[model samples]
Target chain A: MTGSLTLRAGLLSCILLTAFLVVWHLATRGAGVAVEMDPEYAALMGATATQGVSAMPGPLEVGATLWRHLRDPFYVNGTNDMGVGIQIAYSIARVGIGYLLAVAVAVPVGFLIGMSPLMSRALDPFIQVMKPISPLAWMPLALYTIKDSGLSAIFVIFICSLWPMLVNTAFGVASVRKEWLNVARTLEVGPLRRAFLVILPAAAPTILTGMRISIGIAWLVIVAAEMLVGGTGIGYFVWNEWNNLSITNVITAILVIGVIGMILDQMLARLARLVTFPE
Target chain B: MTTPRFISMEGIARRYPAPGGGRTTIFEDLWLPVQRGEFVCVIGHSGCGKTTVLNILAGLDSPSEGTVIVDGQAISGPSLDRAVIFQGHALLPWRSVLGNVTFAVRSRWPDKPREWVEAQARRFIALVGLAGAERKRPAELSGGMKQRVGIARALSIEPKILLMDEPFSALDALTRGTLQDEVRRICLDTGQTTFMITHDVDEAMYLADRIVLMTNGPGACIAEIVENPLPRERDRTDLHRHPHYYTLRNHLLDFLVTRSRTFRDSPPPGYDRRHPPVVRPGAAPQPVPVPETGDTLPLAQFANRRHP
Candidate 1:
């Protein structure tokens, strides 16, 4: 039954994709009536002015461009021109570094807050105040202080990724079953061992959930951060493509960004499943 | 006469600040002592603070106004000498049965080699009849099986005292009976000093050498300690066939149903907090002094048949 359901879902997806492509093909098939115009002006007027083709690239055009990029994804020609793979790699690198740094800082701090009521109460106000602010809101301050666009983008990813992990870790740790804690106490497990063996394992699934959320937010924020900083990354690639009037590349970058985000989310999801217990 | 008891709770009291003001005393001036190998059960209704008493004994909790001396030394915190089997069967769900037991064994003896630790764990797993299920996680196991892992984990530590907080209360009747039998057998064989809290009268009768009865709270206290008259070797199947079975059963039931409530208003003629009266129901018949007599009067008459 599950297999048939999956097969039906796949078949529906294919039908949707086919219908979308056919509509796109039909919409972009016609051109405006040929109009008398000077050659030089016609060249500058572009397709929208000289012809009736939609400004939106047809499915075929986007697919061809996608195929080309995939074929040679990692090539680099100049400062302004690089392969699609290179752009994605840059975005991933920034997100990875920032996200990892956030993990290193947030998890320990979260544990402290979770384990100690004093720290939890003391840190709660600061966290509450900072958590809702947009990641891009920090871009100006980061760029001003860091004086480096790439590093500023990384800092924004770090900030955006911090809260979900920190809050989840703290909540998970604080709410660990009292019975389990009591078990640890009766066993006379020491502070360090108890934290590592009991508390860490118990809170791991929650912590991983936080990580998944952080990675998603980090992926989203990195794009906007890159656009603002105007350097490397898929966000810059999209903006650069837009400036060059290449909607195909922009669409391609969007698709790639989505796929990467899903992959990152799934990676953390798998990790979460690994740590989850039946009880 | 001068020798310290195996486990002595001296003047222990538990209180929490009341909502409006002052304090609500759950129990006060509680005192009890156990011999080296005795199995003791504390029986009380909900809100009677029986589990709190067990927690204090385990050193997972502290009494407001007293100390617990275990084996000639004061216990300030949870010690390896005491292990608790939590009511929820608090096995680390992430760990397999073996891993759970090994965790406790390793904690109890950190310097022991890995093989030695595992061997000790496996031995206890076998003792609890969970040897083949060592690789199974707590979630993969049935309720009874999960509790078996809990038992294995607690026993693997080989503590000086085994503390249980209604460990079998969560299981079905058949499972509870079987687990009770297993626990009874293990305790008897090892002579491991055990203290448990339960509301089940039969459980107290079957396992406890002496059952400590508590009155209802905001100020609960040990009303009496009933000594078990049945031989320790008695079987669970034909337990009722024993001569003293109904006498013991009826006495506990009577105390729980009626005497537990009114005992606080008017304790017997001579009641002591430090040393609650120890009664043996089957031994003799003794009338307890009551200020008011009615239908509830006869139950109290046979219930506290003090043996001293």
Candidate 2:
């Protein structure tokens, strides 16, 4: 019965998504914006030829266009491009690179800052002053200095992701118990072992919490960053659809983007669960 | 298990830097001639520098005034040779009970294989009566269980001296009783030389072969040292039934409580003279015993734990 209920919930979710798409289809199909009649679209072609009417393609026409391109690809990621799959792969790649870089540097630096009072106090002023500025604010400088749109986007993601990790690392390190340190001393664990075995594990959950927040913020920034640069990311897809005055395409991209972001956040949440309280 | 002198701390005195700068003498010119297998408990009021004194003996801290020579060697920084079981267990929250014990062993004897270490730790987990719960973390264990882990960790090293700083004081009454009995049994069985500090007079009276009573703080000294006349195998549950138990408890109680009245009422020597009543109202400048001198009698001079 429990298994059947889970199946029912799964089906219900698909049904709800379909219903939402249908409502979206109805609302945006013939709504105010004018789509020039295209001869290539079969339904629009019939209306254009029979009634001499300039009938733009509707929701179904766009779906048919999307369906045609779904599998027929131009190898964007290893073997596939010019399709929705490749578009997703491209965005995922950017998020992965940018987020990985952010993590590699931030975690160590954060730990260092956290472990030492002098470092935390020394660097605190800079972090506080920099964290509040909009991640978008770095775009202009990144574009000019970095000399590449993709690199600029990555740099923004890096900037957005770093603050959480660094702050969290500092906090996690600072909160390790003095008694625990005493245990380390008594055991005669060297400084390196003390940090890795005792201090790191003790502070791991908090550090992961910081990473989760950092990644979520990074995911949020990618969309805005892609919108700024006219590229082949999911964010660019939204902007491109808006230009054609197709609200349905815009809404579809929004849904896809939201779903992808949720997946990314969940991945991080699972990672957080794996490195947790020690037994 | 019978052995020679395990721990010998001779002429130990500890002084702390007075808040501003100069040293405030806490203890001075002391002598201790502990045998290899004897159990000594120090009973003192708070700030008697009980913890400080224990730390010095444990090699966690150095004596600002005198030296602690242990097992024929002058004590240095923390070592496995002197195992300290601190109050509150001091178990790492990250490790299981077994892991905590094994870690202490592995660290001291780094060359020992993991399998051998595991076997050693397993033996002790069963010995402490936490056989099945070895995998559970410190947080999952009761306070008493955690302290058992602490004891197990201390014993794992097979150190010459076992130093405890009020190991059972933090526990609840029942748990405290259980641990006290377990500790007593372990010490007796192993014949490990032990030094413990506690505020509980009964705990001191019940556990120690001899109880060392410390005077009140701010340079408090040892007022008295009473040897427990009871047998080592005496039942802990019925300890208070011993006629000397009440008598000893009363002596300690009177020293801690009733004696304070005398100190409060008595004026400091030479308070009325030199300084006028206007200078310092009703309070007379009391005669604080300026510590005469703190000199450590060489630990080698002791009956045991002496080197040629």
Candidate 3:
């Protein structure tokens, strides 16, 4: 039954894609109206000078541009003309470093807060005030203090990713089953061993859930951060293409951003599954 | 002969502050003792603080007013010397049956090699009749199987006292009976000191050498300690046919059904708080012989005839 359902769903997706392509082709197809103008002026008009073609590129045009980008994805023609792969690679690296730094700081702090009610209460007000502010809101301060736009962008990703993970780890560690803690106590397991053996395993699934959330938010914030900082990232590629009025390149960058975001989310999803246990 | 007290609770009282002003006493001025290698069960209704007493003995909880001395040392907190079998089984769901048992074994003997820990855990698992289920997680095991894992884990620790709080109360009747039999056999063979709390009178009779009965609470106390009259080798199937079975069963039933509620208001004359009276209900002036054939006398009539 599931196999048949999957086949039908695939068929429907094919039909939808075909319909969308057909509509796009028809809309962008230029009317053949011959305008009586001087040869020099007509040459300056570029695609508009053709008998009846619209200036807007159709799906066919976008597909050709996407094919060219894929063919030479890592070409570095100049500072502003790097290939799509290089741009995406730069974005991914920034997100990776920022997210790892967040995990290093958040998890241990989260553990301290979760394990102690006094710490949880004391830090709660600070976390509440800091959590809801946008990562972009910190851009001016980050740029001024760090004096490096690239590092500031990475710092934004870190700040955006930290709260979900910290909150989740704290909540998970705090709510570990009382009976399991009692078992450790009765066994006379020392505090450090008990944390690793009993509390860690018991709270693992929750901690992973928090990490998954943080990774997704980090990926999302990295794009906007890169656009603001404007060095070498998929988000900057889209903005640069828009400035050049290359609509096809802008559309291609959007598609690449979506695919990479999905892959990043899927990676974290698999990690979450690895830590989950049947209860 | 005076038996040396392997464990003793001196003037233990557990109380919680009431909602408005004063404290609510769950139980107060309670004293009890267990000789080495003895099986004792505390029987009482809900709210009687039977579990509190057991927790105090296990060093998992502190009494508001007294100390629990085990092997001549006052216990301040949980120790490796006492192992508890929780009512919920409380097996770490992520751990396999052998893993759960080995965790305790490793905790008790951190210097032991991996193979030695595995061997020790395997022995206890096999003893609990869970030999073939060593790799199964708690989620994969049945309720009875999970509880067997709990038993194996507790036993592998080699505690000086095994503290159980209604360990079999969650199982079905058949499973409870089988586990009880397993427990009785293991305790008898090893002469392990055990203190258990249960509401099941039949379970108390089948396993305990002495059953401690508590009156109902807000301030419960040890009402009496009744010595089990049946031989240690008594069979569960024919337990009813034993000469003093009905007398002992009815005495426990009467206390739970009626006396536990009123014992607090009207204390028995000259009842000592520190040394609760030990009663042998079936030991009347005239001895009753073991029934040879099918004796069909009703339980109430049999109890009255012997005790009266």
On TM-score, the candidate that comes out on top is: 1
Task: Give the per-residue lDDT digits (tens) of candidate 1, residues B178-259.
Answer: 9999999999999999999999999999999999999999799888888899998979889999999999999999999999
How large is the interface RMSD of each prediction? 0.9, 2.6, 0.8
| TM-scores for every candidate against the unseen true structure | 0.93, 0.79, 0.92
lDDT of 3 by residue, B114-231 (tens): 9999999999999999999999989999899999999999999999999999999999999999999999999999999999999999999999999999999989999888888898
**What residue runs in model 3 are displaced by over 4 Å at the alpha carbon?**
A1-8, A31-56, B285-308
DockQ of each: 0.76, 0.42, 0.69
- Candidate 2 structure lDDT: 0.75
Task: Please name the candidate that would achieve the greatest DockQ relative to the true structure.
Answer: 1
lDDT of each: 0.88, 0.75, 0.89
lDDT of 3: 0.89
True contacts kept of 3: 0.91
Order of all candidates by DockQ, from best down to worst? Answer: 1, 3, 2
| Model 2 ranges with Cα > 4 A deviation | A1-81, B1-33, B61-65, B260-308
